[model samples]
Target: MNILMALSQLEVTGAEVYATQVGNTLAQRGHKVFYVSDTLNSPHQGQYFKLRFNKRSLPRRVWHVFYLIYLIFRYKIQLVHAHSRASGWSAYVACRLTNTPMITTVHGRQPVHRSRKKFHALGYHAVAVCENIARQIVRDLGVAESQVSVLRNGVDSQVFKPLAANHGAKPVIQIIGRLTGPKGQLVYQLLEQCIDLAANQVQVISGSQIDPIFDKFKTKVKFCGYSANIRQTISQADLVIGAGRVAMEALMCQKPVFAVGEANAIGLISVDNLASAMASNFGDVADGGKTELDIDYPQLAKQLRSALKQPKVDEEVYQIITEQYSLEKMTQRLLELYQSAYVYTKKREIPIIMYHRVIHNDPSQHGVYGTYVTLERLEQHFQTIQRMGLSPITFQQLDEIGLDHRFDHGKRYIILTFDDGFKDNYDLLLPLLKKYQFKAMIYAVTGTDHNRWDVEHPSKPDQRFELMSPQQLRDIDRSGYVEIGGHTVNHPKLASLSHAEQQHEIAYNKAQLESLLERPLYSFAYPYGDHNEQTKRLAKQAGYTYTVATDSGPVALHEDLQQIRRIVMFPSTTKFGLWRKIKGNYTIKKAAKPQTKNLS
Candidate 1:
């Protein structure tokens, strides 16, 4: 699968780091990844495009949308993952225009306003870094709870794990963050009140430039600007002070962390407050209704003093980080989300109604495997479909629509399919189809005119039915109401046959049908809806654009075109049952039921 990762930033951020790590993991797993961002700070394993996503000009935003659409089509991108609001806005519009699927990761708290609520571009799904951010997204942006997932930032334990302990006279305390905005203010406040300069050595690891206010403490505090190897700097520290991913990495290294962030302040992360600290992303996010950091200078000072003195290593912290916050675990979760979002965005919910034999007599007396529906019941089914304003379409038409990407969300369509090419389909079903001006596809077995397979079977030898003859199939093909498809020369379970046998059965029957009708067939049906991967490949090799099964397939229609799912219509089916089956949730509901034989 091709995936695009979009980020709107001028400098390296936690979101950028997260996206790069996940993208590299996906690339290693054979997925093609592409990056589009204002700047690339981390080493990415895929192609990168430089775009000014952080710029808010109207023309630049429109250009972003167009370029994204081009990338989606040119690369055949299956999904897009936007990491910030500025990029997500353009990505959302591009995805909507191209009918592509996208998801957004909300890395931090967003400002609440009317425009933010109304124009929130959180795509088909939103991933929040923590529970607090998830709640804020739902409450502030009006995104549904079901669409929001709370996934914390992952830490690479291999690089950040505990090294030899630093046993020094005075403990080394490190503060790691960008010295701007709320983080800069927090740094200043900590230096002025929380840190006891006489007892512990302080190191500030940030950018190259330093604020003038920090000059007063320059003599006492070490300003180590922008170390490329953060793990080395972290290894030298006895206690790390930061928030979000920094706190997680510190815990992975088996070092104590003083968690403070833009939103709030967590004095020290311990087993007692670990859950709360994780929920708020180590104090990078506030609880509901709180906008600023809740700080107590004297209390924080006391906690810091105690932590510096003890500097105890908690094994539980390391265990939790290794188990729940590992890079591999996070990458797997992200892959699941990408596939789900892709299905949600690209799937068409048109229900395909399956029938085997339409008889005039009472079906219960002769029905086996629920394959028969009475003529009266069939008419009633057609009436229900017409009353519900659903347009009946053939598999050929469906293929054309899918190829053109012209599915309209406002219109509803249902596929009426008849298996086995029974004589009753032409004798009893054609008149009703003509009366209603509906289209149907019938799968025909070209080698025989009778149900020899079923009649010869030991299970139910008494059950036998005549098949449509070659002339009858030709007449139906010319009727413009029904299309003919292949169902093999004999109705044998394809899965039971060898690969060569399956190939001969599928390809020979398709050839016979095309020769008889002087036209190509577009669809095929597996006998008994029984097939394996080899049989599916044979069907594709036979030139059928679509092949269908009874019930075993992916829920999304486009996910597995070779094994399209169909809803079996029983003799006892009512209008209400048909109505329920035609809805989008029927496949999901039926999946929960126990598996049964696919007699159709």
Candidate 2:
């Protein structure tokens, strides 16, 4: 499938970066994904094309009209997927002339100026990143039920890991994103709300902007510039306060996040909820008719005051991030979405989830896999998605899902992939997937040394495990239910290996897996789910087309193809867990608040 993705701007933003990630992943999956950005010199792009679109010109449409046609011929694009409104309008024109399937993934609300309703009808399909936005596109924008679909923004759960959340005896809260533009004032808003709550218990931390306004709250506000250590910074927070998607990022760190309404990028906050959050009296009390309001500073203070009298840990949020929003589960959904899009004919991003070991009795083994989720919990996870009308698929069928097909069908779909075929995965988890009849990809690690460690024969002395045997792998592959990819012979960090060593690990494992499954194999999984410049070059040199990484963020078009990220779903989730995760309602509760710190 040939796909040409269009980007209106190249600023370091969520939308641009996300588009690149989607495009690259599509290319890796054997779909010819081409990216055309407003700026020709986009740092994150592949096979770039120049699309002449100047908003200033009266007949800016004139340049767009011709360029759209030109791009059709240039890329032989069967479909055009535009990221932003301006680009969507241009792509709509091209779709009209070329009669090609053009879709504008309506990431957010339609711009106030453009005749978005009309432009939306011009395209074959539309995608909204969140349910609130999707409902708005359908209700307010008047896009047809058939034309509009919900494809929420996803994150690679692993890349964004939970760090030590302790504050060295002082409470800390992390605020993310740039302080310029709409995000700048959020610090002040947060500070306003936290003033009484943070008086002495919390040290507010912002990773970027340092503004004079924050000086007023100097004792409580912390301004740290562009923290490279996201996990560490987020870990210290007793609470995570952020704007827009940063709220979700804070959630990924397993911290409870309270977002000021102005910071919510997707506009999911209902005006009423903001009013409730703003209501000063209730301190984290559950009003019977109204949902429990959790952000009231007085209520929070009461809770903190109560907590101070008891025993509590600082790393509490870490547990939630791993359980509900990990890269493993996220990637599982991503793979499902990709495969669904392959067959459905719409443009969207999907992540392939990666999980390490599943646990039995040994606490050490359980630690390696993080908290082990019970099988009953797994059943609830699958049941939640099933009830929601999302069809879970396996990784092998991903190749069969046609990208040109997702639109015409009313049903939305996704693929579930589990990386690093661990013993517990085969024993406990595979049964559930089989019960559900879902498909997934398993990147097997093969080699002389790898085969020696048997998972079934765990030694009492911290029993190290073994990779699945070639015969067992063949049995799994023969079922036609799973796709076997290489996970290198040894599970060392790919970035640490020499180029030649990396090639051998990748190439040799590919051949070994191919012989076991007797199938064409080309996909590669980074060992430790880690990849660097050297590792990526080695994968290409070794002939694998698709590679997955641990970077925690949603897949987008402009992202580098080989360096993709996924979510790691863990055991901490409850019955309502998968629902909130899938329906994109993680931070909808505390959608609005105020912040005092700024991070530039």
Top of the candidates by lDDT: 1
lDDT of each: 0.83, 0.55
Question: How big is the positional error of residue 10 in model 1, measured in Å on the Cα after superposition?
Answer: 2.1
Task: State the lDDT at 559 in candidate 2.
Answer: 34
lDDT tens string, model 2, 256-278?
Answer: 55545331321112223433321
**How many backbone overlaps does candidate 1 show?**
0
Best by TM-score: 1
Error of 2 at 453 (Å): 54
Q: Model 1: per-residue lDDT, tens digit, 123-233?
A: 877888888998998898897787888877877777777866689888899999888777888899999999988788999998636889888999899999877678888
lDDT computed for candidate 1: 0.83
Report model 1's TM-score to 2 decimal places: 0.64
Measured against the true structure, the TM-scores of the candidates, in listed sequence, are 0.64, 0.45
